[model samples]
Target chain A: MTPALELSSIEGGYEPGLPILRGASLAVAPGEIVALLGPNGAGKSTLVKAAAGLVPIWSGQVFLNGRDITRTPAHRMVQEGLGFVPQTENIFANLSVLENLQLAAALVPKDRRGELSKMFALFPDLERLRKLPAGRLSGGQRQMLAVARALVASPSVLMLDEPSAGLSPKLIGVVFERLQAVREAGVTILLVEQNVKAALAIADRAAVLVEGRERLVGAAADLAQDPRLAGLYLGAGLEAA
Target chain B: MLQLLADGLVVGSVIALGAVGLTLTYSILRFANFGQGEFLTWGAYLAVTALGFVVAVTGGGVMQPIGPFSFGWELLVAMVIAAALTAGLALLVDWLLFQRLRARGAAITLVIASFGAALALRNLLQFLYGTLPEYYTREIQIAIRLVPRDVLGGLRITPDQLLVIGMTGAVVLGLHLLLTRTTLGRAMRATAMNPALARVAGVDVAAVIRATWIIGAALAAVAGVFAGLVGQIRPGLGFELLLPLFAAAILGGIGSVWGAVLGGFIVGLAESFSVPIFGAEYRAATAFLVLIAILLLRPNGLFGEKP
Candidate 1:
């Protein structure tokens, strides 16, 4: 079966000559949850951004459902069935919760704007605070609002960058549970996470990267038992293993 | 005191019209457009040109005063034409000059480019119409006394002053509706707050920018026409008012629409009241004084959020 999102040997970074992602390859099948794990400066976020067209891929192809979308602008990617939630400032802080949903819905066809109710159903907490500004919400609530906003676009592939960051441990559990529910709903998810154990619990597959190269890719359960994960993540001579 | 208020309202109306445009553009464009004042001059000139054409077409016949108004229906028609023409010119200026500079993402360059645009537009007006001041109508209507000379120290207001105030109120109300009730307005506010998020959400950022220019120039045109009706229109007409317009925009919190209106009234009253203490020659100075004080005390202006 064709994957929902595929990044093939992607070479990209912030600057033209400085490449943070070098020959990074990852594929997420439809209805699958893939957690991208790596330490700081491991280019995990860069790979996700490149897939979402936020980072410029100097040399590679990004495919969404077998169609190459390598050159699509970041703003147009949503209409093409790709939704991305950045780690920070993902929600429109100044707008009310309803306005945030309405703004995203406006991009979709008029007939499909009714999906907002589905989003509200998925995140009933957002419905309770619909009138309040997104800025006033708690950290976890804001993250939920951001995810709901992306989901309202009805993207076939949702890419989240560090969704669990800045959340309390209890809230982190809620976020992971929500991610599981989202994957169960048949939306392919590419999650960039630092919490390896929690991510593995929900992720169908996991990929580890170090210094812009993919070090390991396997089923979540297989990677969870591998003794080399610490060495691979911390750069402690994984080549010997 | 009543007469001063009456006079202040007339001046306040003009400033408010210009300030609304100025504030909106500043918030959305993220630049102080020096060329905004020229929209007023262009509007007034466009109206006068249209009036001249109308007079020539009918051999100056069928022209008659409408009640207390100095000019007839032809001037009203001309005002509409002027507003439309000025709006078009504003769009043209943005297309020809500002848009390219904006793409470079240099705030100072955009501001300097606006200054350059202002010079070109102001000079173009001067070349087309001479430097001498011109009025919409040569006829001077006497002020209507609301209170007799014996009552309230001879309080009175002219028809033109009343019309200016009425138009300002209508425009302000219309703007309030546009900003609060419409989807386009919500998009505009969203764009102003976070352009990146707005764009990703599928707002046509370019369309919003174009709409902003149209609204800004349209309101400024009305202010220009009123300026001519109340006093006189000259090449330097908008230039002289530009400083006061900026003062009002800053005093109103730089981005808030209602703040701009309130700031305009405050500035107008300050100017009018200063006449008794510092003479009419220092009227403009009072506007700046109030602006400086507001900046020092409340850097964000009254309606501005803590940014």
Candidate 2:
């Protein structure tokens, strides 16, 4: 099957000459959850941002289900079935939870704007706190609101940058469960995570990256036991024990 | 005191309308937009020109005063035409100037460009209409006493003053509903809060920018027409009001609509009351003094979040 999102030999960065992603590439199949695990400065986030059209892709083709979306403006990518939730400022902090969802749904056609009820059903806590500003919510609740906000647009693929970053362990569990539920509902997910164990638990495949390059890619269960990941994450090669 | 209050309300209404547009543009675009005052000048001149055209084309039939008000139906029609034209001018300026500066991505550059635009626009008005002041109507209508002299030192207001206050109330209420109750408003708030996140969520940000200019310029046009109704219109009219308008916007909180309205009243009241204390010559100085005090006391203004 053609991957829902394919980034082949991508090279890009915030500026024209200083490329952070140098020939970095990854692909995720339809309805699959792919976890991109890497240390700080691994260019994982840049890879996804390049794919989302947020960063300038100097020389690489980003294909969404075989359709070239390279150079597509960030705002137009959503209509083409790409939804990106950044690690920070993902939800409108000043806006109420309900308003956040409504604003996302506005991107779709008028007839397709009834995703509020569906989102509320998925996150009942958000329904109760619908009137509160997202800023007032706890760290965990804000993350949930952010994810629900991205889902409100009903994109074919959802890309999140470190949804578990700064989240409590219990909240992280809840977020992973929500990601699984999203996958079961037929939407593919590409997650950039620092929490390798938690990510592998929900992801279909795990890709380990280092220094703007993919170091390893395989089944999540197999990659979970790989010694190289331990070495790469610690920034020191692991000794045989 | 009651007389000052009445005068303050009329002045406050014009400031409130102009401040709303100022705050809106400032919030979404992240620039002070020094050129915004010219929107007021342009609106006033446009309304007068439009009214002139209508009177000339119709042989002055529509120029007859309607009851107590000096303005006829032509003035009302002219205000609408002015608003539309002003909105168009705003969009045109955004496209021709601000949009290009925005693409280059420096807040200071945009501010400098706005100042350049302001100078150009104000001069263009002066070149076209001359520096001499103009009025919407030549007729001077007497103020009607609203409060008895024995009970409250005799508070009085003109028909046009009442209209300014009424229209300000209506426009502010309508804007409140738009920002709080509509999807477009939510998108605007979201964009103001985080442009990148709003775009990622699928908002047509360009469309939002266009709408912002339209709404902001339209409100400015109404305020300009009211300013002309209440006072005289000259090339320097908008420039003279610029400092007070900024004072009101900062006093209300930079990005909050309700804050702008309250700030307008506070600034207007300060100016009106200062006429007795500091004399009329220092009225503009009082407005700047109030702004400095607010900044010293509450750096975030009344409703602004601390940067």
Candidate 3:
């Protein structure tokens, strides 16, 4: 089967001197949940941004569903069945919850409105608060709203950058539950997470990002089982392994 | 005297018309454009010349009224031409000056540049028309009297003032409908609230700004024409009008349409009323005073959210 997302040795940066993602590469097939794991400042967000067309890629090419989209702007990416939810400032505070989703729906292919309506059933909470201003939403509710906004577009592949970043543990569980529901719907999902163990437990595939580079790539179970992950992530220092 | 208020309503009507343009520009462009005032002056002058030429060709005179109510076809035609020309000229300014500045990521500098633009436009008008105060040949024959007989020694409302008030209502009505019920209008509001987000949502921002310039400058031009007809026509016509026009925009909320209209009439009436107590020379200055007072009390004009 064709990979949903394929990054072939991409090198990208916001500035000339310091490249954010340097010759990093990864791929995921449709209906798969892939976890991108890293320590803080590992260029994980940078890699996702470059692939999403937010960051400028100085070298290499990116492909979405086998089509080359190396230099496509973010909005065009949205049109091409790719949706990105950034790690920060993901929603317009002044607009109503319904307005945000309406904007996303406005981008959907006209023929797929029926399918889009089915997708909206995944997050019923959003429907309840649709008319409320986005600013008034709780941290968890806002994250849900952000995801719902993107999902309303009925994108083929969704890239979420730390969707659970600011949420409480209970909310994080709720967020992942929604992700599992999304994965069940046959859409490919690529997620970046600092919460390593939980993400690994849920992911089919995993990639470890270092400073502008990918240090390891493997099955999520294999990475989680490896003893070194405790030291690489946990502040108790690297345990003898 | 009641005559002062009748005159107040007249002056207020003119200010409301002129100020709407400035307010709309402020809302769409997200800046206080000092040059907006000069568009009014240019519009007025253009109408004077264009309509005068039309009348000359038609063999009409100031002695004859166009119909029963107001100025002739010459005035109406000139007003339309002036509005179109001003909008065109404003686009030129946007292309040559403000557009590049925005692209370069210059914010405050653009505000200062607008001031420079206003000054340049003013001086250019002075050069072409000379410093003389010119008037449109009065073509209207009817005089509408509404004031009580005992008040301020026979106060009267001119046909021009009545027409201006009516025009103001029509302009506001047209603008409201356009903004609320159209796709282009919705896109403009979306862009104004958040430009980057609007672009991401498939709005053509460049086109919106261009349309905004056209709308804003057109209003300014018509306002300029009314001011000339109501009072005098000169290079300083717009310059003097700026403060009160801005007062209305600020009063309405810098970017809000309803706010601009409300602010326009308020500043207009304030300036007119002040004329009685402080003399006609103090008219323009009254706008600033009211603005300062509003700034102290609300600081966001009357209806606008703080920027």
Candidate 4:
């Protein structure tokens, strides 16, 4: 079966001639959560951002459900059923929670605008604080709102860049639980995360990126037990073993 | 005191309209567009030209006074046409200049380019309309005393000034609704706050930028026409108001619409009230003083969030 989202030999970065992602590639299967794990400067976020069309791709191909979308503008990605959530400043803080969701929903075609009530149902705290400015939300609640904003467009695949970055362990668990619920709701997820253990717990598959490329790809259950996973993060080449 | 209040409000209406555009452009585009004043100038001159065309087409009768106002349906129609044309001019400037500069990804460069664009636009207006001041109508509008001389120094306002104040209120209200209730408005606010996130959420940011120019320039046009009606139109009209416009935008908070309106009025009132103590020569100085005070006390502006 074709992957829901595919990045092939991607090389990109913020500026030309200074690539952060060098030949990184990954494929996320439909209806499965694939966590993109990597250490600092591993180009994990860069890989997903390039696929989402936020970062410029120097040379690569990004396929969404088998359709080439490498040259698609970032704004058009949503209409094409691809959603991205940045790690920082992901939510429009100046906008109220309802306005944030409403703004996202308004961008998609009327038929594809997923029910706001469904999102509010999934994140009940958001429904309670719907009228509050997103800036005022707690760390975990902001993450929930960011996830809900991306989900509001009803994209086929959602890519999140470090949703668990600033949250407490308990909040991370709460957020991870919500991600599981989101996956059960039938959306493919490519999550870029630093909290490896929490991410692996929910992800069916995980790709470990090292030095701008995915150096390891395995089932989450097996990878969690593999000693090489820790080595890859420690900057020790797998080939050295 | 009442007369000063009335005069201040009349002036405030124009500043408010201009500042709203400035604030919106600053919020969304992330640049202090020095060329904004030229839009006001262009709008005024465009109305002057459109009004002439309208009067010529419909005959001299269209120029007849409507009720207490000095202008008739001809000027009103001209104001609408000028507004559309001014919006077009703004789009053209964006396409020909700002868009290319935007691709370079430098805010300071855009600001510098706007200064250049402003010079070009102002000079072009001068070339077309000349340095002599023009008026929409030569009809004299007598100021009506609304209060007795004993009551708080009384109040007197011309019909044109009243119209300016009334129209400003209506336009600002419409804008408020558009920002708070409409999808496009929210998109603008979103784009202003976080453009990258807005794009990922599926907002066509380029289209939003274009819409912003249209709305901002269109309001500038209305303000221009009102300025021409209340006083005289000249190539330097907008340039003259540029200081107060920036003062109002910053005072109200660089991104807030209502803040601009309130800032405009405060600046206008301060200037009017200052004339008594500081003399007419220092009217413009009051805006700078208010701007400095606001900067010192509330750097984030009245409505702006801490950066």
Candidate 5:
């Protein structure tokens, strides 16, 4: 079956000559959660951002449900059925929680706007704090709001960069549990995460990126047991492993 | 003191309107657009041209005074047309200049371009309208005394001044509703706070930028027309108010709308009260002194988020 989201031999960066994502590639199946795992400067976030159209792609092809969207503008990606959530500044801090969700919901056609109510149902805490500014939300609550904002457009694919970054272990578990529930709702997820154990617990498959490329791809259950996973994260050569 | 307070409010209304646009542009576009003053100048001059057209088309009856106000229904119609035209002008300038500079992703370049655009726009207005000041109406009215001379230094105001104050309140209320209730307003606020996130959330950021120019320019146009009603329209009208506009925006915490309005009033009152100590010629200087003093105490501005 065709994957829901696909990145093929992507190469790109902020500057022309300085590439952050070099020949990186991944494919996420429909309704599956795929964690993109890597160490610092591994280009994990860069790969996702490039696919989302935030970072310029020097040469690559990004396919959403088999349609090429490599050249699409970042703002139009949601309309094209792709959503991205950055690790930092992911929420509009100055806007109230309801305004944030309403703003995102407005981008969809009128009939699809009802998804906003469904979001409030999915994240009841957000509904309770609907009138509060997003900046005042706790770390975990902010992550929920960010994910909800992306989900408001009802995109076929959702990519989040490190939703568990600043949260406590319990909050990370809570957030990952929500991600699992989101997957059951029929959305494909490409999650870039540093919290490997938490990500693997929810992800069906995980891709370990090293030096701007995916160096390992396996089922989450198998990858969690593989000693090479730690070696990859530790910058150990494949020969050493 | 009462008369000064009344006069200060009248002046503050115009400054508040103009500063709203300046602050919005600064917040969203991430630049101090010196060309904003030209929008005010252009708005005023555009109203003059539009009013002349309206009078020519509707006959002199349209120019007849409406109740206590000096201007007729024609001037109101002209103000609307001028606002639309000013919005279009702002969009055109953005398309021709700012948009290109924006692609370069340098705030300073956009600022420098705005200065050049301002100079070009002001000189173009001078060339088109000539150096002579223009007026919306020639009829004059006497100030009505609201209080006796013994009662707190007396109070006096003209019908036009009251209209300015009332209209400013209505416009500001409308803007407040737009910001708080409308989807576009939320999008604008979202874009202002976090542009990248706004885009990922499916907002068309380019459309938001266009809307910013339209709303900002439209407000500036109304302010220009009001200024002309209170004083006279000239090439330097907007340029003269530019400093105070910036001061007001900065004082209110560059991105806060209500802050801009309050800052405008404070600056206006300072200028008005300073007429006694510093003299009328130093009115502008007094505004800067207030700005400096306030900045020294609160560097981020009154409403601005602490960095």
Candidate 6:
């Protein structure tokens, strides 16, 4: 299948010549969830930021469904079916929960607005908290709000950075289960996750990043059992475990 | 003591009007505009010019008599003209300066630029209208009795003071109702909380900004006109009022309407009481003193939220 989000020879960061990504490139096929497993500070965030057009790519090009969008603004990119749910500080704290969803819908067309109800259906708590301020939400509820915000745009590709961060064990199960439902709904998902086992279980394919470079790329279960991965990163962390 | 209260209420009304403008812009625009007081001055000066036109057209000699009410309709005419003129100027200021600054992500720079705009506008008024003081021709003001003489010490009043207090009360009540019970006001409040989020929710920020300028400038003009009628009118009428006007706004809280209204009367009473304790020259100094006290006691003004 043709890749939905194609990144080739992509290099970017906050400044010129001093790139954080270091020639990083990857792709996500339509109706597939690709887990990008990496250690902390392995340029995972940098790659996602660049793909979302928040940071300029210094050298390489980015394509969305075969169309070039190397210079689009982050808001406009949301309209073109590329959704980014950042790690933190994503939703406006003072705005109402319903307002947060409506804001996401601003990037979408009016005709496609029936999906808004479908969005609220996915997050029952947010529907209940629709008139209440977003600041009143719990950490788990807030993450769900952020995720629901991006998904409301009905994007073809959704990039989530560490969806399970700062959540309880029970909340983590609920979040991953919702993500599974999202993947089943046929949107391409490119995830940056630290939970290797949970991510690999849902992912069709995976890319292993170590120190700002793609160390290995393979089928999800194959890399999960790879001897090199087992010895280098996970195996090392697991040895103590 | 009674005369001071009466005079204080009249001046307090002007402050309340001016403070409404200051606070409205502060809430909607989310910035402390140091230049609004000068707009009040400009509004007064414009009122005189509007009065001149009214006289030339009707040959009624500038200050028209208010039929048997012991008041002047000339001041009434000036107020309307002043409100219209200042509202237009306010719109122009946003179109050229503040709006572009907002679009370019220059919040602090826009605040500073409003000061520059204020200085330029103030100087332009000074150049056009010289330093001489003027006022509407004096008419017999029939006092509305509230208390008889020799009741605790003494209680006296004037029709002008009663009129001023009456008008100020009406405007405040009207504005309070408008803010509490309007769709546009609700949208304006939401925009103030977060502009980006407001845009995402499909609120037209430009329309809201325009309305803000109009309301702010109109309130300033109302204060300016009344001040001219009660006190001596001058080219620096608005400039002189700025310190106390802004003091009221800060005391009320940066973005709270109720806070601004309460702050206005508190300031009026303070200025009145201070004149006996500190002398007439120190009247304006009270604004600065209040600022220092607020900084030490309540930095967000009485109405502002906890930092």
After best superposition, candidate 1 residue A46: deviation in angstroms?
3.2
lDDT per residue for candidate 1 within B101-130, as digits (tens), equals 897768888888889999999999999998
lDDT tens digits by residue: candidate 3, A1-241: 7799998898889888788888988998888999999788878888888887778899998888999989887667777778778777677665677767665666556753324356458777877887898878998888887787777667788889999898988999999999999888777899999988779878999988777676677899999887766655543333442
Name every residue pair that clashes in candidate 3. B27-B255, B65-B139, B248-B263, B250-B301, B251-B302, B252-B259, B253-B304
Ranking by TM-score: 4, 5, 2, 1, 3, 6
What tens-digit string does per-residue lDDT give for candidate 1 at A147-191?
988888888899999999999989999988888888888789999
- B114-232 in candidate 5: lDDT tens per residue? 99999999999999999999999999978888999999899988899999999999999999999889988998999899888888887888999999999999999999999999999
Task: Specify the highest-DockQ model's number.
Answer: 4
How much does candidate 3 score in TM-score?
0.83
| Residue runs of model 3 more than 4 Å from their true location after superposition | A104-120, A183-186, A197-203, A227-241, B1-29, B46-68, B72-81, B128-137, B147-156, B177-180
Worst 10 residues of 3 chain B by lDDT: B61-70
Candidate whose TM-score is highest: 4
Which residue runs does candidate 4 get wrong by more than 4 Å? B60-62
Candidate 6 has an fnat equal to: 0.09
- Report lDDT (Cα) of residue A2, candidate 1: 91
For candidate 6, report its TM-score. 0.73
**For model 1, what is the error of residue B257's alpha carbon versus the real structure, in angstroms, after optimal superposition?**
1.8
Between prediction 1 and prediction 5, which has the larger lDDT?
5
User: What docking grade does candidate 3 earn?
Assistant: acceptable
Cα lDDT tens digits for candidate 4, A11-128: 9899889989899889999999999998899999889889989999988899999999997999999999999989999999989999999989988999999899999899999999
For model 1, chain A alone compared with the true chain A gives a TM-score of 0.97
Best by lDDT: 4
Candidate 6 residue pairs in clash (backbone atoms < 3 Å):
B41-B238, B252-B259
Off by over 4 Å in 2: A111-114, A236-241, B58-62
